[model samples]
Target: MHFQEESIDCVDFVLRKDEVLTVILGGGKGTRLLPLTEKRSKPAVSFGGKYRLIDIPISNSLNSGFEKIFVLTQFNSYSLNRHVHRTYASNAVHQKSFIEIIAAEQTVSSVRWFEGTADAVRKVLPYIREQRPKYVLILSGDQLYNMDLADFMQNHLIDPETEISLACNAVPEDQVYGLGIVKTGIGDSIKEFIEKPQDLEQVESCRQTSGQFLANMGIYIFNTKTLIEVLEDQSLTDFGKEILPKAIQEKKVKAYVYDGYWEDIGTIRAFYEANLMLTDDIPKFNLYLEKTPFYTRARSLPPTKINNAIVNKALISEGTILNHCEIHRSVVGVRQFIDHGTKIYDSIIMGLNRYGSLDRQSGKIPHGIGKNCEIRNAIVDKDCAIGEGVKLLNLKNVTEFEDEFVRIREGIIVVPRHTTIPDGYEI
Candidate 1:
């Protein structure tokens, strides 16, 4: 999606004159990205090799100049919290930044975790109310995309009548149910909103006869006043399931068409596909946009090296050394070492989790060169020593696994770190 002329103006300036607080929703268990999310929340899960999933939104906020940030986390928040403090603690951006973790709590009236997205925000309403932020920017922590939320907020400000502004992208007919299907008027004012529809008839009806269905991008800019009212109303618990539809029905919500690479990494396949997309010759999501560049905690390491390795369309992070190995269509995390004669294809290796169940891909073998080793279409976690002579090529049944030695999720095998499957073993 190309940026429309109107959006260009939205992105060119910081629209909100008042102080804005960015509320990052980081509460999902990410069960769909299992094995990987087995040890960490979706936000703490490493991505693009070196960066964690939370970095995507934090970076977006820093680059967009939205320094005041609050991340709401419920399940598995330890690692997520540590990552934030370590990465966003001492940068020039940090001087003006306030990124913290807000977990689920229990009060006298209620004793449970965040019930829903709206509830998550509502529970923290007092905290935000104390800060008196003029606008509250609510964002998801697991989606893979770079949006200039400043642009989104600007549009909402310009459209004075709007109480809620949602950033959305048009999706295919079959994929509409995974997100909120919205119906809007000509000038992009939202008329109606429906949470995930169950059937084709509902999908077609929400498509607005324009043949393009607007799927929520999980990015929202709310007028703090309206947001507080909606959140306190107890009846409104989820943004997609209640808040949004209610707002649209009241005729005050607007839709901002987001024309950029936005992918909901809600499943293993979607996460894998999004990572592979980054390895393209000229990726659809341009990471090199200077004006509004994607910012992450920089590693002051040397460059990567592929000696005698036949590398093809892959992203290898800094301090990585691949020797006589073939890597194709994969994302290798930082400071990783792929020994000679090893071949990795169509996988994602998050090198940070290099021990215990923390890692995903298990090592090929310890030592025994009787058979040949071939790992194709799999995610090999860090510190896995794939010994010589073990074949992992499951061509006929790509999703089949012989033993628990290698775990499979949505057709991707996860080899946990430091796992030693002795060589000559055939699967």
Candidate 2:
């Protein structure tokens, strides 16, 4: 199925923006993405140099004209809450558009934290009911994609029989191992649904004649009544594992096939590869679109300064200073300071939150990458102070190792936030 640019008349046929409530599920303990999630929530983690992971879904919802949005966060949500408040607080005063953050809280009835995705939404049903929405759009916070959700809403409204609509992408069979696979019988109607099926025969049953399997994108649009009815069962916690499979059996669940670029940054390796993919000549996920632009906090930082730096295929964010350094296939975030004679390749340098003191004291390591250092295939988190002549090259190619200063996962070294490495140290 092809998704063309929606005409004005087509958009007018869909439900009003106020009648559609959008919910972005801020993820739980992001165990796969270890040190990155150590301090901040998964959605608040930095991505593409400047933007947070939560920005993707919120921007897509706003650009698509669905303004009444709520973000449900659980673990380590302080940074995520702050970012949402500072960036989107202005929208609440508008007539019909607002973005609100709903962190997990305990009430008289329930004291336990959110157990899973469905549970999170179930607990926030009171706020959702206040909007009087006819449909609810569910989104994942840590995904990378630009979708026209207005178009998606229009499609869902076209078929009144569709009580639940799932956005699906066609992926190879090999990629369906950890993903929810759906089998469509006729005319986009899902016949069977399985979450991470381990048996090969079960997976093969979902493969299409085009040699691809339909994998769930974790994007769901549900009729307000259907959502409430499914959540009535307290036993069902997760949507993929518990709720969806049962819904397919009882309700009219349909699949909206999407051929666009989408990546779930669930693991550290996936996050690393996704960040480096932006440095490609023509990345699948385009960040330069004008109509559907990615949104983030508006900062008043100055332009990046490059002093004789031989940079190639890199995304250098604002207010960074590079002095005679050699960088290739890397993403340097805001307010970074890289001294001379440093070489960075295939790495992500998450810049500092604020500029550190420049006064060079004896044995005092300053923030950012120091001089004469070598870093390759690693992720340097925010506010890290790497001493001069330190090396993070993972020379031994260790698959997994962890220490106080750094961690090596999948052969990529990660310097956690605010770590200060001594001078002349080597990994």
The global C-alpha lDDT for each of the candidates, from Candidate 1 onward, is: 0.74, 0.90
Q: What residue pairs clash in candidate 1, if any at all? A: 360-415, 360-416, 361-381, 361-415, 361-416, 362-415, 362-416, 371-389, 372-390, 373-390
Residue-level lDDT of model 2, residues 1-427, one tens digit each, is 0112253344463455647999999998999999999999899999999999999999988778777889999899999999998887754346566788998999988998999999999999999999989999999999998898877877787889999999999988778889999999777899999899896688788888999999999999999999999999999999999999999989999999889999999999999999999999999999988778888898999999999999999999999999999999999999999999999999999998998786567557889888999999999999999989999988899999998899998888999999999889998
What would the per-residue lDDT of candidate 1 be over residues 212-286, giving only the tens digit for each residue?
788988799888898977776886678888888777766488889987888888887787788878898888776
Model 1, CA-based lDDT: 0.74
Could you tell me the TM-score of candidate 2? Answer: 0.96
Check candidate 2 and list the clashing pairs: none
Q: How far out, in Å, is residue 394 in model 2? A: 0.9
